[model samples]
Target chain A: MVIALCVTVALAIMPLVGVPKSWILYIFLFFIYLAMANMWNLLAGYSGLVSLCQPAFLGLAGYAMTIGTWLDIPWWAGMIGGSLIAGLFALLISSAVFRLSGVYFAIGTLVVPEALRMIFFLWRPVGGAMHGAGAGYMIKGIGDLSPHVVYWLSIFVGVGSLFLVKGILRSKLGLGLSAIRDNERAASSSGIDVFRLKLYVFIISAIITGFAGTIYYLYQGYIEPTATFNVRWTMTLLLATVIGGIRTVEGPVVGTVVVVFLYFLLARYAGYSLLIQGIILVGIMLISPQGIVGILRRSKFYDSIVKRMK
Target chain B: MIYGGDIITPILMGIMLGGLYALIALGLSLVFGVMRLINLAHGDFVVMGSYIGYALMRNFGIDPILGLIISIPVMFVLGFFIQKYLMGRAFAIASEIPLIIAFGISLIIQNAHQIIWTPLSRALNTPYSHMSFHIGERQFPVSYLLDFVAGILIMLFLRWFLKRTYLGMAITAASQDKRVAQLMGINTGRVYGYAFAIAMVSAAIAGVFLGMTFPFTPTSGISFLTIAFGTVVIGGLGSMLGTFIGGIILGVVQTIGGYLFGPASQMLLVYIIVLVILAIRPQGLFGK
Candidate 1:
């Protein structure tokens, strides 16, 4: 809640200092990524699923927002509605897929999104399949209410997602899911009901992802199957989680901020963006398995500060 | 909807196309089975193979068919060295490291290909390019026949090598368990190197066949890679026979789905099949 207040205050101050609208847009997009990376980290880093399909849920959410707007619904309600729909979809999928272990589950999750993209591409109601859905946006009273509003909304969502995850982790269901991660057989023997726990996490993760999609589409004012549900989004989210310290709350936010900043700075180059991300991901994993934040936490400086505070 | 022409031709094409799919997936299956690493760069390697074939044909006046022989060996050597130097260290970290590194490698190669070849799509042309034999009302390309025969021959040779050669046995044993292979006094690193090399060689051959059959852009490999992955999973990972059959199943799905639902729906058909299969038999059709 404090972090939310600080971010909201800071966002209000940014435009006063002559910051460009593009930078503000990038900042908003960064929060969308933060939301995505956090949700994925919670599901895979904590639950040990190693999923590469979170983007699919995001795509579904984005399309749902567009559809809802076209049908004359309130935009915020559409965002929540999209998230609910994605959550339901994830719940349905997890019941069957949670039975698989390791690679199979990873591969299985990937199939639905790819298939959904194809289905959407062919469906006529959502716009001419190949042409993609038109610019789907709801104009408020006066043209987007400035970039500051979008930035504040994004920050609220990002911090709120973290708080939600933190609350869940302290609850009984989170403990069961974590236990399922450590060893399914042992968790089952302990009467944790492994399948139910997995389904819950999957649904929760999907809802968060769906919100990310809605925000992305609203800000961008467009939806394309190729871009919204691209495999690269999955990879980017995974990279953020892995780089920022997978199983922690602050990890994904830090990682997403760092990577997105790097991507923006390096946008001019053709291949260097990918090259840098690849090197960072591979290098960090090999040298420090716990990720960049984990390294920071383990450092002597961080330890000394923590000891002093205690 | 299932007429003789619609049913028979699609199935036949699917089986024939499965041969090509098997070739594309062979490298991926071999590397994963042997090294326990999914080389995300596997698709890029195939893309490199297409370029190699193109280079050989354009420069030396070699037919695209003969280009495979030169390209395959070069890819093998490249793979061998890549494993010895880069991938060997990745094994020390978690399995995900290699995947990230390989994905980076994919990006690098894709960009390199774009720079070298430009964004243009190229098709291999030969005297036999348009030649086809008519069977009943359906026409089958001669190149497809050659592709099928070559795929089977390669699989047979691979199976024979695994069963008969010392190095092949070492590769298989290594894949089964590195500790066991090490305990048997095998140089586990060398087996990994050899296995990665052979997989690249197969990928090179697949690339040549794919290039000959269709026009290829640098980005063309992504769709094929996805399909190949779906095939490998359905055929059951590490099972050669399963990979072969899985390719056909995917091809059949694509062809029939294309016929019935339109071209766009083919991928959806395959994805749905994978979901159902994974839900029912997560181990895959023939996975160990």
Candidate 2:
């Protein structure tokens, strides 16, 4: 815990200490991805909901924030409001999607963003005439804010997500979630409110994902339907969580760092990045479905560390 | 009479369009019904077929329709190996593992297409690509007619193969109960491979038709997958007859919706219809 605090302090102070702007940007991206991956882990790794509708929340929140800014709302307030809208959207679709189980649920949710993409493309809620193929909107205001402020916001959400996951896992709600993940019928038979527990996790993840997305678009200073609602978002989250540890608290952190590194490393080769990531994902799943953390857990080093801690 | 033409023409076009949609849904329905595996990459496979046809046409001067003679066999072999090796192994580990693997395959195929073909839209151009038949005041594209015929023929062929062929019966038995089929001396693994291969054959055929019908990019796979999935769900999973009817329903809805609200809202309407159907009957129209 002391080590974690020191790391957070160091991260918080890096911008003030005259770090390179590129480094700050990289860290900012890492924090946002970590937050998103953490929430994804909470849902898929812990609660057993392999949702593919994450782009919907992310995109919706982005649009909300952009539109909110257009209406003279502050970016921070828009961020909160956008997240709430995402949560509400989740609630609205939950009844329909929750009915389907496993892969069907994943697919059912996958179409939500596609539907939203079409709607946004067609309906210019706050815009006049289609600008381009995407019909995107530029975020109003927020031009004067320093990168440090954005970086700080990302840190709060990123660290906040980590602590949030830790809190949930240690709480009664976490226990119920794991129980539900293991066996829904069994959990319900044993007096757990399976539906309610799943819904709670679902809404929570949606809201946080929305929050992270809002921060990302805020940093980018633009929001577009095609890019925002792109399936690549979910693909990134899946790749990160699955590659890291899944079900483990440190999984998203590890995964996000690797993914961000890969993102920069492969930034020059835009076409091949997704292909390489796909290959990595398939290779990892085939070789070690348990992921990096899972592999780590079985190592002698991990075992020795556990023994020493005990 | 002019007003009648607008309504009647769209409905006619929709019916033909639905026939093609049913063909696209066939492979997805078969895979899901028999193996209970939703190949998320199924649309990519269809798009791959289009690329294969495109290659045959560009390189060898073969017609896209004639190119299917090579593409069908190629896809069949690819499907067999993918199921026999990758998906089969993944299934042994867990049910959902294949789904993820399929997603991986989708990403690979989409990116590979972008890399190889460039991201520009392409379509198969036949000699009669622009030819249309006039029925009174309305003109129907020859491609649509050909698509409808090919779809019906394949459906008929599938029905016959499943009923008459020994391998087909084995597939049916295995789909019914893997363990029971194994006990009865059928190699369930091989049956699964064959079933998947056959499904790929259908996807290849559908891909060629789809390419002929519309211009497509590497990223067009997802939209195709959505259409196939919508067809399967609306028709009923694993039921041949239901797929036909369901494809028609979706086709009609899409066409009419497009007519009423323009092209952008077409997919949105399909999605709404799918969600509504799922909410009302998750088992689908013909699913047990």
lDDT of 2 by residue, B1-288 (tens): 011336778778888889889988899988998899888899999999899999999999999988988998899999999999989999987776788888889989999999999999999988896699987889889888877887788888887888799998999999999999999999999999999999999999999999999888999998889898999889888877788788888988888887777776876788899988887887689888
Extract clashing residue pairs from model 1.
Answer: none
Give the least accurate 10-residue stretch of model 1 chain B, judged by summed lDDT: B1-10
Weakest ten-residue segment in model 1 chain A by summed lDDT: A134-143
Quality of model 2 by C-alpha lDDT? 0.87
Scored by DockQ, the top model is 2
Docking class of 1: medium
Pick by TM-score: which candidate is best?
2
Model 2 chain B: lowest-lDDT 10 consecutive positions? B1-10
- Per-residue accuracy of model 2 over A146-179 as CA lDDT, tens digit each: 8788889999999999999989998999999988
Error of 2 at A178 (Å): 1.4
**Residue runs of model 1 more than 4 Å from their true location after superposition:** A1-8, A126-147, A302-310, B1-5
Which whole-number lDDT from 0 to 100 does residue B123 have in model 1? 72
